[model samples]
Target: MLPDEPRSSADPSPEGGPPGCFRHPGTATGISCTRCERPICPECMVPAAVGFQCPECVSRGHAGSRRATTRFGGGLAGDGGLVTRVLVGVNVVVWLLAAYVLTPQLGQTWSLFSAGRDVLGGPAGIADGPDQWYRLLTATFLHVEWWHIGLNMVVLLWLGPPLEEALGRLRFLALYLVAALGGSTFAFLVAGNLMNSVGASGAIFGLIGATIVLQLHNRGPLAPVMAFLVFNLVVTFSRPGVDWRAHLGGLVLGTLTAAGLMYAPREHRGPVQALVVAGALAVEAALLLIGMSLYGA
Candidate 1:
């Protein structure tokens, strides 16, 4: 029998010999892999888009599972989106109302300060609600001057949509809020009592950290983002009043959180993600407790 001889379709075997599984020659099977056309028993057959294929043909390495994507992670974002747009809109509207209508008054409220006289820039000893608690998140929204808010908003506009798309509405929102919390919380504890902090640099830097973590999972281009992040870090530290500590806190927390998110097996994804988030928050809470012990706040 010639090796290249064409077997009839109705013959039920590759070479019309006794019908049996290719993998298990002793076991007979009528089914065959669609691509390789090797005989596959019911056990070896895996259902594919068109038909069953032998496990060997169907099995793709890590690269084969995902759809082809653009240079950036392409889970979504090309489509005009709601979450990112809405978030940006809120920031813009808030900035407009605060910057124009409310003016200096709004700026005073949305800055990081503890329960004491602010010796540096901010009004001394704001009311308890705005001073201790609200500042953490509100600080994310407020900026000192026009250039400050302008830069942060531009970055958010560019970065947020793609991220929101990749992470889904719930996960993305959770990440942003926590990033802001972690950043502000770090400032509250570590920064000197006199210093006041504002702006979304921490959250934006968190996005940078998330992007880095995601690259590990997806295996995308590294050079561009790395250079960009490094440049930003240098500028953040070198510039006056940058709150490098807030950026560090947000960056670290976001990276760890994203790492937990990407590392989880798809089957047990949610619970694993929750564990990571809870663990991160636990660490923050511990730090808060220590700060309270020392500082008596």
Candidate 2:
């Protein structure tokens, strides 16, 4: 038989006030831990299967039991979509700084380019120099136009949360960064060296590709997602001033990254996921090197 668990009693304070939290005696609280029955204030309470548990009880329970994971090996904690919200906030902040504070022309410095040129009476772009390689990632977050950022953020908010929940936060972030790099590399290789490209469309397209792969892995319905992807592809090719190369590169790399995560062997999932992201980066680097050499920069 299981031993009886010790229960804490909610005793009144010496001052004759209502019972206070065990952790913070100065704060009165009516709620008690579900398991140990210790008094817990709102901040100290953690939602449990039944009622709230104190921080200590929750930690103990977690230590004693295996933590739950998503089907793709991601921890269930990512269900809150905190990373997605933060990404949106960061994008908005960067946009505000670039558009208003620094001036849009100056913001173009963050754009991806294999070669630099004068635009609007100002020198812009990285000039295919190795030192400013950060532009590959930064360009993903830089957007000057309202509609451009608005559309990308909406897509990111729609797709990022579910992907984060399925793949876990770190893996999801890896996928995003790698896809963004892939898109930038592709743009650098294919777009005119003097042409500058900026926006999160590539990363957003990467999310779309990852979502499609995930849906396929889970045996979920494919028609809706496929239709969405097709429509976007059409828009990509049909629209002028849109960099199709970035979208294509992001989609290809993101799909490959998700496939690696979803199909990895259960026994070696973590290492394989890491390898997949690393492989994608390696390929991007190799492509960039070859492109640079061919461009004679």
Error of 1 at 273 (Å): 1.3
**Tens digits of lDDT, candidate 1, 1-297:** 578987443345655665678888767777878898887878898988787998778665334877643232224445535676776777777788777888788877677655433333332432233335666788888766778778887877777776676776667766777777778777656853545778888888888888887777689887776887899999988999789988988888877777776676666776877787788778766655454443432
lDDT of each: 0.71, 0.83
Q: How does model 1 score by TM-score?
A: 0.67
Best by lDDT: 2
| TM-score of every prediction relative to native | 0.67, 0.76
Return the lDDT, model 2, position 121: 24
Worst ten in a row by lDDT for model 1: 122-131
Residue 26's lDDT in candidate 2: 73
> How accurate locally is residue 269 in candidate 1, as Cα lDDT from 0 to 100?
71
RMSD (CA, angstroms), candidate 2: 7.7
Q: Stretches of candidate 2 above 4 Å error?
A: 1-64, 116-127
Tell me the deviation in Å of residue 210 in model 2. Answer: 0.8
